[model samples]
Target chain A: MEFLSYLISGISLGSVYAIIALGYTMVYGIAKMLNFAHGDVIMIGGYISFCAMSYLNFPGWLALILAMVVCTALGVVIEGLAYRPLREATSLAVLITAIGVSYFLQNSALLIWGATPKVFSPIVEGTQNIGGLSVSNISLLTMAACIVIMVVLTLFTSKTKMGKAMRACSEDKGAAQLMGINVNRTISTTFAIGSALAAVAGVLMCSAYPTLMPTTGSMPGIKAFTAAVFGGIGSIPGAFLGGILLGIIEALAKAYLSTQLSNSIVFAVLIIVLLVRPAGLLGKYVPEKV
Target chain B: MLKVNDINVYYGSIHAIKGVSFEVHQGEVVTLIGANGAGKSTILQTVSGLLRSKTGSVEFLGENLGNVAPHKIVAKGLAHVPEGRRVFLQMTVEENLEMGAFTRPGSEVDSGIADVYKRFPRLEERRRQIAGTLSGGEQQMLAMGRALMSKPQLLMLDEPSMGLAPLLVEQIFEIIKELHKAGTTILLVEQNAQMALSVADRGYVLETGKIVTTGTGAELLNDDAVKKAYLGA
Candidate 1:
């Protein structure tokens, strides 16, 4: 029973990580940008949703929509101001700018929301029993929602017109532009969608856990990022798989091993994975054209 | 249909294309032939708005193409199929073709795609296959086919024949001729001087970014200097 509980918890947490990892993977795939500010964006999403729920007294659905709208706007502005200028700059310059944006956004939140953690009341309450196992309704909801979102995102990317353009841009921006796809617009839209997904994850996570810290996103963001790399930074499904795998591994380690070395165990897994598959589990090795 | 006047393109401080000038009349196939590093691609890049010229003007169909983004250039009926046959490798051939008409309306774009499939029947067969999986010649065809999907008034091709089998090179050049016959203005840049000049109605010789020579294709092919320098006669 305890093992099943652990498994459920791991899967639930993994679903969140997977959602966040999609943002990291998608941005990296299309823009070849790290977008280190992604975690802070999630932090902002949680705070904004909390603000809408508490201060504006918005209904559940309305608050969720408002949170998404705010996060989308934030994404667009960041891309326009912080990212656009660095579009033609070297990868290093863009990455450093990402770090700068990350710090700036996080600190700005710190100033506005304060450093204390805020409790978020769950949209859905109570426990549910499934197959002789008890699960929190919030956790099950979070998992199901993430799975649906992932499926929709996957289909959108693989089957739609704009999605095709995005894939092209991911493969080669110059080539995409040559095909008459507006590269800049495509990039901006990518950031918007990726951040919006992260925002949804943020809201879902806070609802399930009931705590919204200004820095709540930092650790999870890093973990999601690591999952992105582990699955293959440029591969969409890879990010999902990597995130869930990491989540399950972490949960098992915490359950069976000493809590003191849980983090270390996770890092050790990463190191082993890296040593085995340098390009990542699903990453393809692209040869340089001389 | 395209006029480049005294254009100077600089990469940082290096004058890559210095004082380059040329014209491609409507419905004419104009070739810019040179050795490597001769700024052939640079001229194409500038005309297509991928690279902005430091000094001089590029007018396409009486409109100044100054500081316009590359994608916008396509909307204005100017399409550039960049060097290296830069097809979106991860996308399927159909997706690549769909992206070509990104600026067009949905119905018209679908019709345009149908037109491309008709033009390059091979592309239709490989529509479901990823572009990177295509053979070199097929990829080249997809590249040209993708540019055609933009319904371009003036199509700029950079090094279409690079890294192709000799037979494939012949096929690609033949397609260029056919495209010209279909009333698409072509500005072809090539290091394959011999083949380029043969098919071009008019040819310009670019040496280190400046137009050193310009004449009818046959005239340049027969020019003693061109023969000695480029033709290896």
Candidate 2:
């Protein structure tokens, strides 16, 4: 019974990581740059929703929408201002700039929201007992939301014209441009969608933990990055599978082994998997042809 | 329909194109034939807005294409089928063609795709197959079919025969001739001078970034200098 409960919660947490991982994988796939500020963007999303609900007196649903919209705009702005100029720069330079943006976002959140953690109310307030397993409504909702988002994203990428453009840009930016797809707009749209996903993850995470802090997204951000790398950084389904597997592993480790060793276990697994299959579970190895 | 006037282009410190100028009329197949590193592709890139010229201008259909974005250049009825047949490796042939018509209205996309499929039935057969797995000939067909999907007035092909079997090269050139007969103006950049000149209405021989000779396709094909320099005679 305890194992089942732990698995449930682990899946919920994994969904959060999956959502955030989608952002990292997508931006990296299309723009070929890591937006290290992605995790901080989650913090900003939480803060926006928190501010909307508590200070602005907005409804919960409205607050969520507001957070998504603002985060989408912020993502586009950040890409245009901080990353677009560095499109042709070396990977090292872009990586450093991303780290700088991450720190800048964290500090800005700290200055505005302060160091004290704020309590957040769960979006849904109840528990559901299914087949003798008592599951928090938030967990079920999180999993449901993640599944829905994944399905919709898959449809969007596979069916829509803009989605095809995004895939084309990822494959070859120069060729995409030659086809008359606006490369800049496609990149901005990618950032917008990624940041919007981060917002949802942030809100769900805060609802589950019932706490909001400037550093709240830091750990989850790193974990999600790990998830992305584990699942093939550019593959969407890979991100989903990697997040759930990592979450379940961490949960099982914490339950069976010492709590202090859970983090070490998770990283050890990552290292072993990388050594065995460097491309991650679902990543394809693409060789450069001369 | 296109005119390049004394355009000078540089790749950082290396001047790739030096005051080169040419024109492509509304219904003629114009060929730019040169040896490797002779700036044929550079001229195409500059006209397509992928690279900027240090001096001079490119006028397409009488509109000066200065500082215009690449996508906008395509919207204005200029499609560049880049070198290496740069088809999206992960995407299917149909999806690649769909991307070609990206600037067009949604209502026109289906017909555009159908048109490409009609032109290259091989693409229709492998519509759902990933582009990377296709043979070199099929990839080249897909690349050209993709460019045609945009319904451009002028199509610029950069080395369409690069790394293809001799038979496939002949077939590709036949398709190029067919496209020209169907009224799509062509700016062909090629190292296969014999085939390119055979199909082109006019020819420009570029040497070390300069247009050293210009004449009718037959005139250049028969010229002693061009024969000695490019034909391996």
Candidate 3:
């Protein structure tokens, strides 16, 4: 019974990681650069929701939506201001700039939200009995939300025109531009979508843990990034699979192994997987054309 | 329909194109032919707004294309089929064609794709297959068919016969002739002087980024200098 409960919670936590990983994966896919600041965007999302709910006395759904909206705008602005200018620059330069942006966001959040942490009320409370196994409502809700998002995202990328444009840009930016697709706009839209997902992750993660702080998103952001790399950095389904597996591993390790070593164990497993399959589980290995 | 005046382009310290000037009138099939590193592709790229000329201007359809984005250049009825057949390899053949109509109306995309499919029946046959899986000749055909989906008034083909079998090269030239007959103005850049000159209405011979000779296709094809230098006589 305890194992079942831990597994469900693990899935819930995995769902949060999956959401964050989606942000990382999508941005990297289209822009071909890691937005190291993605973790901070989640912190902003959590802060936005916390303010909306407690300070503004808004409903939970409204807070989520507001957070998503704010995060989307923030993502676009960050891409335009920080990443766009570096478009023609080297990968090392861009990577360094991303780290700078990450620090900027972290510090700004520190100035605005201060160092104190806030407790959160679960967005969906209570328990649900499933086949004689008890699952918390938040766990069920998180898992359900992840499934819905995965389905919608898959369809959006496969069926919609904008989605197709995104895929084209990822494949070849110069060719996509030649095809009359606006490469800049496609990249901007990707950042918008990614940050919106981060916002949802922020809210759900805070709900499960019931604590909100400026640094709340940093740790999970790193975990989800690992998950993204674990499953194949640019593959959507890979992010989800990696996140779920990561969550399960963490949960199981904490339950069975020493709690002090669970985080280390998670990272050690990632190193092993990468050594075995360097491109992650589903990453495509393309040879350089001479 | 297009004019490039006194253009100078540099790649870092290397002066790739030096004060080159050219123009293409409506309904004319113009060809730029040269040996490797003669700046034929550079001229096409500059005209398509991919590269900026430090000096001089490009006028297309009466509007000066001053720093217009490449996609906007396509929107203005100029489609460039770049060298090396840079097709979206992961996309299906049909999707690549659909992408070509990205600047057009959504309602007209189907018609545009239908027209391309009609022109290249091989593309229609492998419409559902990934572009990377296609043979070199098939990918080249797919690239040209995709550009046609844009329904541009002027089509710029950069080395259409590049890396293809001799038979495929003949077939591609035949299609170019057919497209010319269908009233699409063309700017062809090629190292295959014989094939390019055969289809060109007018030809410009570029040597080290300068126009060394200019004449009718037949005139250049028969010129002793052109024959000696490029025709490998």
Candidate 4:
């Protein structure tokens, strides 16, 4: 019974990581650049929702939507201002710029919100008992939200015309342009979708953990990145699977072994998986033909 | 009609195309036959807006294409089936065709796809299969079918027979002839001088980024210099 409880909570935690990992994977897949500041976007989302709900007395649902909109716009602006200029630069240079943007976001949050951690009220209150297992409403909601977003995203990518264009751009930017698909506009849309997912993850994470700080996104961001690499950086289903697997391993390690070693165990699993399959579980190896 | 006048293109420090000029009038199959590194692909790229010519003018249908973006160039009724086929490897044949009609109206896309299917029944058979899984000849067919989906008035083919069996090469040229008969203006670049000269109405011989000779297909096919340099006979 205790193991079942731990597994449930672990899945809930994994759902949050999956949501965030989706953003990272999608951006990496389409633009071929990792947005290191993605985690900071989550922190910003949480802060915005907190301020709106507490200070401005906005309703819970309205606050969530506001955070999503702000984060989406911020994502597009960041791509235009920071990443666009470096599109032709070396990947190392773009990566350094991403790290710089990440630090800048963290510093700005600190200046505005201070070092003190803020408490977040649960968006969904109470608990439900199912088959002798007591599940918090927030936990169930987090899982449901993750599943819903996944379905919608899958449908959007596979069915819509814009989605086809995005896939084409990811495959070959030059060919996509030849086909009359606007490469710049497609990349911008990818960033917008990624940042909005970060907002969703941020709100769910704060509700589950009930704490907010400038550095709150850092650990989750790293974990979600690990998840992306574990599942396959460019594969959507890979991100989802990698997040859950990492979460379960961490939870089990904390429960059975030392809690202090849980972080180490998570990374150990990544190294082992990478050794076996360098491209991640679902990633296909593409060779350059002469 | 498409006209390229005195176009000089540079790749950084290397002068790739130097003062190259050519004209393709409406409803004509024009072939540019050259040895490798003679700037055949560069000329096609410049006309497609992939590579900008530092000094020269490209006029397509009476409009200057000097500053048009690559995607906008497609909207102007010109389509480039780039070298290497460059098909969306991971996408299906049908999806590849859909992408070809990306600039067309949504309502017209289905019919465009249907037209491509009718042209290449092989594509219809493997429409659901990933493009990378298709054989080289099938991929070439898919690439041409994809370009046709755009309803292009002028279609540019860059080395459609780059690496194929001799029989497949013959079949591909036959299709090109068929397309020309169907009223599609074609700009063909090929290293296979014999086949290209046979099907083309007009021919230009390129040597070291310059048009060394221009004539009717029969005139160039029988030219003493062209036969010695390009044709084995």
Q: What is the interface RMSD of each candidate, in Å?
A: 2.4, 1.9, 2.3, 1.9
Tens-place lDDT digits, model 3, residues B26-65: 9989999999999999999898888889999999998899
Give one digit per residue, the lDDT tens place, for model 4 in A39-113: 999999999999989999888788889999999999999999999899879999999999998999899999999
Displacement of residue B17 (Cα, Å) in model 4 is 1.1
Q: Which is superior by lDDT, 1 or 2?
A: 2
Weakest lDDT window of 10 consecutive positions for candidate 3 chain B = B129-138
lDDT by residue for model 4 (B102-155), tens = 999999988998888888889999999889888889999999999998899999
TM-score of 3: 0.98
* Clash numbers, per candidate: 0, 0, 0, 0
Model 2 residue runs over 4 Å out of place are A286-290
Please provide TM-scores, in order, for all candidate models, with all chains considered together: 0.97, 0.98, 0.98, 0.97
CA shift at B23, candidate 1, in angstroms?
0.8
Query: What value does the lDDT take at residue B19 in candidate 2?
Result: 94
Give the Cα error of residue A60 in candidate 3, in Å: 0.7
Worst 10 residues of 1 chain A by lDDT: A281-290
List, for all models, the DockQ compared with the true complex: 0.62, 0.68, 0.59, 0.64
